[model samples]
Target: MSSLSRRKFLLTAGATAVGTAILHGCTSGGNAPQTPASPSTNASPAAGGEAPEVTKAKLGFIALTDAAPLIVAKEKGLFAKYGMTEVEVLKQASWPVTRDNLELGSGGGGIDGAHILTPMPYLMSLGTITKTKKPLPMYILARLNTQGQGISVANVYKELKVALDSKPLKEAFAKAKAGGKELKVAMTFPGGTHDLWMRYWLAAGGIVPGKDVSVIPVPPPQMVANMKVGNMESFCVGEPWNAQLVNQKLGYSALITGQLWKNHPEKAFGMRKDWVDQNPKAAQALLKAVLEAQQWCDDPANKEEMVKIISDRQYLKVPPKDILGRLQGKVDFGDGRTIDDPDLAMKFWRDNASYPYKSHDLWFLTEDIRWGYLPASTDTKKIIDEVNREDLWKQAAQAIGVPVEQIPTSSSRGVETFFDGVKFDPENPKAYLDSLKIKTIKA
Candidate 1:
């Protein structure tokens, strides 16, 4: 059989096995507590519209600052305003935990949706990273935030002056390896956003990620503690953890990811496809609440209040100081370099940050293929169409009276140029793959 046909056969067979397992009371494991009961069919609708079929959903989020929109929506009663009074934004311990819970689903002790890494829904939908290898269909309702993630290096390499150019760090790793020490770098999860960023940064410096050094998974909240005990040399993750690392004097921020690719897409508001299909009106209500929260978060005047709310013990649980500076676009790299550029801050609504661009999804799938995470013959467009729910976003936007000018006219964001002068044109993904100097897959 051809490679593509073999892959298709495996996926189909695996799904059938998973279905049998579910029927026999065997399912993926997770410790997530049972969520509130599913939305009631009799719940009253909000003013001026038909009531949502369900008025409740359980959504998971990590402690990263990018999750602020979800936090804000719940904390500020935006969800209630949209008639979703029982929305629960629970905290997830790690990306893998999030995946497991999603697979279990709300009825089965998992979540209905989450504030997640942009590439994760696609990964889960393909069954590439699921525990049962059963495709868990998902939808991308909105892009939660862009930029703000960071690549931080332990103080051991502080003198190397490693920033965007990773050559200095590469030599240090090589020297350590020669002396019988195998250097390890960490990201939030394999084939996720942070993994792609860390890999791209290393590859751009002519260093092969998996061959020259070991790349491992480290949860975002554990990054600093792990580095302090000399667990990993470096890590890529979203803010407040990176900011906390700098505040604790454990590491220095080498570069905010915006320096890698300006305003790159990051976290997403994603829901299980089953939940969306069963509760279309409730889904739109949830999207409207998050969209309003995103606008509120992007406003400069609300920055301080937003930080304080998300820093509460129930949410991020970190001090507001660690999250505020970076959230305000004031970055202290902890290595004698600082920049105050609001344009580089994490954006929730400005510059169309909330829109789920098909082009961005394509880039992520292409990157997954490049790293051998997905089959080379994977149908990128079909997957994007199946997962991205930008149409839902537009409908919600119009329902909420969003200015027509703010709505994007095209799905593609055009060609994106990375810091190293490499460009990714969604129109021709093969050309972008061929241009990479280091990769596991041949275009």
Candidate 2:
């Protein structure tokens, strides 16, 4: 077959696999039927004792384990308990689809908010990755999760034993290019968490992402299928896709992202700024419900039920086994390596995981600048101040009686240290960028 035909065939096969997964209960676009809201209750009073102005919200989620809090809130009646009776937690096909639906808004047959990549709202607010390059102001109410994502490598590279250090694959990628087969790596979306993770992994190994190997965007669900068809050498995505890849014996996880940066921020629960401004009480109600759900999901005793509920056809649609292990921090790298460390597990509420720290947001923006996704001249702090609604998170946590200890004393999580000894001091992102050996933006 011609190379073009072969490429098309592979993509088609991957698409077919994605379709099958969707049929088994993944969400696709705005047309997917909404999951019926749990039974309603008396409208819960908001922070200031005002009743919610509206009871419904159209929220989007992809089929990943980090999205558990949103799914749990919807299934366990948390949303309804907080007076959001008509909340619809619909499934989204991919990150780009989620962005499109969020841009459309509920009134335009889209979503009002989503379980989204941490950098996405800032990207959207800046109009960098939008349909018309028009800014859509957004507010991040709370962080959904911390540290459950993974970078996976194809079994072909098993001999190299590529893990957190990607240097082993640098020469291999160069050889492939010299041999007339340019390798490609996949992530979920440009400027999204997966993309940044993949880029950082490769660059840390002295591999220039877009230059050394093509970095393409593949929706999270399709990562396994695409790798199975030889469409990419590696991928970065949230679980249980990585676990599924290992389960299917298609690839071995290089590293769970916690190893990249322990307890690093992953996803956020964000909504259209206009929506939040117009319906402040309803917004707090939604936040309160999700906050409660986060605490529920964090409990070790609830792990079984949490996995079962999210594995249903309407949510993630995967076997509970594929999700439970990683969700509990029992990682089987699928290459005969296993570790049980709850500290590296996906955190929903513990360790202030639910707080939308301004420092974390700044790190994301700083990384975006490093990759030239956002200009070096960008005012990251101003954008972060405007977009990160940590104050609202504090309000919801207090309203829900979250222990004062759980509520962060400061918006910054302090300096974060990575597996490679790289430090990102929230107070000085410029120095962090300067310290990086490979970056598109010069420090």
Number of the top-ranking candidate, with TM-score as the measure: 2
TM-score of 1: 0.90
Worst 10 residues of 1 by lDDT: 13-22
Reference-based TM-score of each model: 0.90, 0.90
Task: Rate residue 396 of model 2 by lDDT.
Answer: 82
* Model 1 steric clash pairs: 45-51
Q: What is the lDDT of candidate 2?
A: 0.82
Model 1 CA deviation exceeding 4 Å by range = 1-45
* Stretches > 4 Å off in candidate 2: 1-48
Model 2 vs truth, CA RMSD: 9.0
In order, what lDDT does every prediction score?
0.83, 0.82
Q: What tens-digit string does per-residue lDDT give for candidate 1 at 34-59?
A: 21111223323465664788888999
Q: lDDT per residue, candidate 2, 79-157, as tens digits? A: 8887788999999888878889988999999999999998888888888777878888999999998899999999999
How far off is residue 320 in model 1, in Å?
0.5
